[model samples]
Every structure is written in C-alpha cells, then in structure tokens.
Target: MSSTDIEPAESRRPARYHAKREAILAAAALAINEQSAKGLTLADVGRRVGLTTTSVTYYFKKKEDLAAACFSRTLDKLLEILDQALEEPTPQLRVRRYLSLHMARLARIQAGQEAPFAVLSDLRAMEDPLRGQLLAGWRTVFRRTRSLWGSPATRVHADLYGARAHLLLEKTFWLPVWLDRYDAHEFDRLEARMMQLLTHGVAAEGQSWAPELIPLVQIQDDETVNRDAFLRVATRLMNEVGYRGASVERISAELKVTKGSFYHHMDAKDDLITACYDRSFNIMTTAQRLSDTVAGNHWRRLSSVLASILNLQLANGEGLLRTTALTSVPAHEFALMLERSHRIAQSYAGMISDGVAEGSMRPVDPFIASQGLVALQNAAFDMRSWASTMPRERAVALYASSLAFGMFDDRVLEAL
Candidate 1:
C-alpha cells in the first residue's frame, strides 16, 4: 500500500477533532459565566465537558487558547445578529430589526434560556493575539453592515447607528442582572425612547435656541510645554491593573524609565489616580460642549448627545471607568467626579425639557425620563466592558434606540 493512501478511520480524524474543539469551547464559556474568566482553568473546562485535561489539551494547547476559543464563539453569536439585521429591506428598518432581535436575544440570555457567555466581560483580559482576532471579527461585521446600506452617508450613519444598537442590547439585557430585577416591559419602553431620540431632535416643535449665543471660554497655561506624560502612563497602567495590583515598578518598566524618574512625576499611586480623574473631567467637559451642538429635532439632538457620551467612554481606553468604579480613590475626588457627572445629566435633562416645551415632545416627565435614559446608557457601558463580544457601534445603536423609546412621544416612537 502507498504511504499516501489513508484508511477511512484516519479520514474522520479531522471531523472528530472539530467536534471535540466545539465541546471544549462550550464548556469553557459555561465555566466563565459561573465563576468569571479569571477563575477559569483547563481542569475546570475539562471537568465540565467530561474530559480529561489531556484530552482537552488535544484541541487547545493551553488555557489561553481555550479562552480564546470561548471568546470567538461568543463573537460568532453577535455576528449572527448583524447578519440578520443586514437582511432587512431598508437601512432604517434594518437598524430597527437589529435592535429588536438583539434585545430578544439578550432577554433569552438573561432568562437563563441558554448558558451564559463571558466574551464581553473578559475581553480586556485577553492576550494580544486573541484581542486582535476579536477586533478583526468586529471589523468584518461592521463592513457587512456598511455594504448592506450601500451609501457613503448611510455607512457613516451606520457607525453611530450600529453602536447605539449594541449599547441598548447590553444595557437592557445586563443591567437587570446587575440590579437583580427583571422588567421586560420597561426594557421595551427604553428601546422605543432611544429610537425616537435618534430619529428626531430633542427640541420640541416651534421651539428654537440661539445656537450661536452659547458662551465659549478660553484658557491660557503659562507652562504651555509642560505635559504630565509620566502621570498619563501611570494612570493608564493603574486603571488597567488596579491600584493595589498595579505597581510603580510595572509602570516604570512600561515607560522604560527608572523608579526615581517615576517618583519625580508623582508622590504615589493615589496621586496619579487623582490626576487621572481631573484629566478625565476636563476631556469629558469638552465632549459635552461638542455634543450640545448637534442640531435637529429634540429627539435627534438628544440622541446625538447620548451617542457622543457613549463614544467618549469607549474611546477613553478600556478599564478607566471600571477602575474608577472598583478602586478606592479619595472620597473627595470621587465626590467631585460624581458632581461633574451630575452636571452632564442636568444638561441632558435641560435639552429634554426644551424639547417638551417646544411641542416637539409630548407631555412627559423630563427629569425622570432623562435620569432613566442616562442610567440605561451607563449600564450599557458597564455591560459592554463586561461582555466584550459586541462591537461598540452595535452597542451604541441598541442603547440609543431603547433610550429613545423611553424618552420620545408615543407618536414619534410609532413612526420609527
């Protein structure tokens, strides 16, 4: 017999290997959902799959490889949503369909209809190789959505539109879990309000604000060239690793500088975190100014502002806000950040009020609606950081659509 000739048994090896790999990945996702990705191990996955560690290793050479496989599988589900959304008749309807399906899927996940997946929550923990793979997957999904719309303008709109979708899905599905509450009807209203806001401007009918009359301030720094590069690196490191876990030594090593040099820039880790909060505030304020200018109906303007806020959080680099939430920063500084966040909320509420007065919005409680909308968006951000499988565009689209439903007039929501 020729060496090139293979028996039927050998030919089936590849098929069997693929099935084994799928089982291992499914087991890993279960382990992660129950105990978090940090606690997942090869042995845990093997036991869950009723296999020996050695047999599991036959598919995934290492625990990291297994983790990557689990993460990819989760992303595959998200991509499936995008695929369904693209099949809709119009770009606008495509977006609506996408949001509806995403919400339903999220509900299923929350109801324990299926095993929990941790790709989103553990994305930051993934090694670079896995992170790259995830990003590539996201890009492919976006590209497909863009192609379906077939217009440059629609593609641009799709970016923000898609982001809103992802944000809403994550918020609706994950927030209730965090708060230990389940209100499907409440989520439905939230989704409707978000869509209304995205499609219409927040300013009510016959109401207009003097756009050019808004005041602008100028700031002058004497030390124009003096930048706190060390503090910047330190903050990012601390945010990524947590204050207790992040060492000055690691920061110094990352910067390729000496410990003495790091000490020259900051007194301690606490000081660095405080500085980061200050910097973040300034950046956030600037973003608020830009978002405030989005001109359209009351709903549209409000959606634009909300979209800007979500984008800012995502762009600030992962883990910064999470670190702020989980770490022990100074109480005074924490209070200050809270005040700043409150101010943003107040501004958003004012826009809603403006819309209500102008007849563009129906009679509704702007204060309660605004607070609820902001809460929904913030929850979505938290969930996105946690799930890490859904793309930022999809998250934002989902959130904006849901929030618009809660905030918009019933008539406007019905049109969307």
Candidate 2:
C-alpha cells in the first residue's frame, strides 16, 4: 500500500497493522541517524514520519520500543550482508566481496545519501532482552563470517579468525565519519586493492623494508604491586571480548589472582576501564610525540605516527584505545577523556594541515582526514591474529601505505 493510504490515527486496527509498525520503525531509523535514540522523542519520530505523537505511541508504547525495533531491523540488514557473502564460491572472494559491499554501503552514508548503521551507543543504551538479542545476532554474523571466509590454519590460534575479522570490522562502523573527505565513489576498488595489498606487502619488488623502532611507553604503574602485568592482562581481555565482557572475575582468573588482589589494584571494574583508557591514550600520545622527534617532512611525520601507533600492537601487543571506553568512565573522567581524545585528533589534524601546507599531501579537510586515519589505524587491533600470521613490519607497512594512498595512485609513497 502507498504511504498516503496509512492513516495518521486509525481508531481501529487494520490487518496490515504490522506493516504500519514496520514503516514507523523505518522512520525511527532515519531519525536516529541525526540524533541518538536516548535523545530522540516520540514527538520527533512522529514529526519525521508525519504522524501525531499519539499515533507513534499507538504502535510502540515507548520511544525505546521504537528504537529497539529499529536496531532489530538493522540486525536484519547485517545478516543480509553475511548471507550474500556466503553465496560466493571462494573463501577469499567471500571475504573480499563482503568487505567491498560493506565499504560501498558506508560510502553512501558518507556522501549523506543514506542513514548510518546502528552506532555503538544504540546497542549499549538499549535495555534488556532486546540488547542481548541484538548482540546475539551480531555475534552470529561474526561467527558465520569467520567460518565462511577465514583460513582454517592461522598462527594466531586455530579458530581465532573471528579475532582477525573484528580487527578489520573495527573501523567499518566509523567509516562514514571520515570517508567523505575522499572521492565518494564505488568503494569496491578499495576492498580489492586493500585485500591484495595486505596479501602482498606494499614493498616494491626487491626493496627491503627497514623496521622502525617504537618503544613501549610506560603508564601510571603505581596502582598495584604488579600494575604493569595487571594492566597488560586487562588490555588483553578488553581487546578480546570487549570492556563489557572483561569482568573483574574473568580478569582475575586470567591473572591467577583473587578478587581481593583485583580490589587491591583498583576499587572496581569501571575504574579499571578508566585506567585502561588513560594508559592507552597516553601510549598513543607518547607515539605522537616520538613521531614528532623524527627528522622529516610532515608526510614523513604522519607516516611515522601511523607506524608508531600500529606498533602499539605490532611491537607491544596492545590494541588501540577505544573511544567508546570514554562513555563507560565516571562523568568527570568522561569529560577528561573526551577532551584528551579531541587533543589527539587535533594533533593529528595539525600534522595533516602541515602536510597540506608543505605540499607533501593533497589538500583535504584536516579534521576529517585525521579522523579517517585514526579509524583506519584502529585496525591495528586486528593485529591480535594478524601479527601472528603476518610479519609485524610488513603488516604495518601495508596499513600505512593503503591508508595513505587509499585507492589513489601516489608515487610519492613509493619513495617515502
């Protein structure tokens, strides 16, 4: 039926009531793109769909219900991608095609032509059974993606293809944010190029890759007797399962320490997460500073910074700090961490701005470009499985080259 046929406030239910509800959920998805679900009101949703607030409430009693329905529908879309990829005949082709199609989808969003996929906030803010159900759906996609695409033999650990997939997927959710800075076009090229680039290191034939040195930056280690070990263990858990899954009990079990030992180090899990965020960002800051000390042009500086950041995982086995960790921190710490994140971005933009000014890089919006770089480097977390299977230096070089050059031909990178 046409949209015009749907009544704004039908006093009686029609046989197509479920279809109408689905329509409302579609509108909710569009509205959610502009504002988070928590900030979204029933009136706003009604405004987006040309319905009265009462009419909206009639379908989904609360705004949360509407948002929940929207998220559930997104899960349907995600599953569709998985199912489509599974149709491909080869494992590598399946993975490549899946990444390509998904990147193209994100490009559409970057061009302001479509709504974003569900954000992390969307999943976390959702209450109860719906959240659990949605995450189960998400996990199902990862498991299927791994089984259908990942190689059976990986040095990272057998059956840990999921870890590698997570690493690649880490940046996909945030792709639209910075992707607009580049030419918004069919991104299948990016998928194919990146896949090939990753398989074959960016090193020109017979050109030896000199591994850059990145030191382990120390963190605030006074929290406990073995704070360094404790933090390292916590970082592993956070990277593996995530902040939510890394319970104090689980972390303690891994550390072979009792709950009292954990308490001795930190008062609670939230505090531990806060410390992890602090240390992770501090490590990045240290890398940024070290990148500055290198004697080279801005392009060289940016490359060094990218290499150093990737080396956090490549050299040290620590993943990049997640921005979502800020929300889980205390309000005051949240504010602080939020500012710190901005500073890091700003510093990154500064380097890009310098690059543009000096003619080492093409002109682009430094802010957006910096963010895009950060999002890409986030794949360093994939190094969990990747570093094991691939040489760290080679992996870092591939990431730096692909991110710097993207789909564009830049001969300068060849010499850099």
lDDT of model 1, residue 184: 59
Question: What is the per-residue lDDT of model 2 for residues 89-117, given as tens digits with 9 covering 90 to 100?
Answer: 87666766667778877777677677665
Worst 10-residue lDDT window for candidate 1 reads 209-218
lDDT of 2 at 366: 65
| lDDT accuracy of residue 282 in candidate 1 | 54
Which candidate has the top score in lDDT?
Answer: 2
* Regions of model 1 farther than 4 Å from truth: 1-27, 30-40, 43-59, 121-129, 153-180, 185-187, 201-231, 234-250, 253-256, 260-416
Tell me the whole-model lDDT of each prediction, alpha carbons only.
Answer: 0.55, 0.63
Q: Name every residue pair that clashes in candidate 2.
A: none
Model 1 lDDT per residue over 13-99, tens place: 877776676677777887765545555689988888789989888877888777666766666666677788878877666666666
lDDT of 1: 0.55
Q: How does each model score on TM-score?
A: 0.56, 0.59
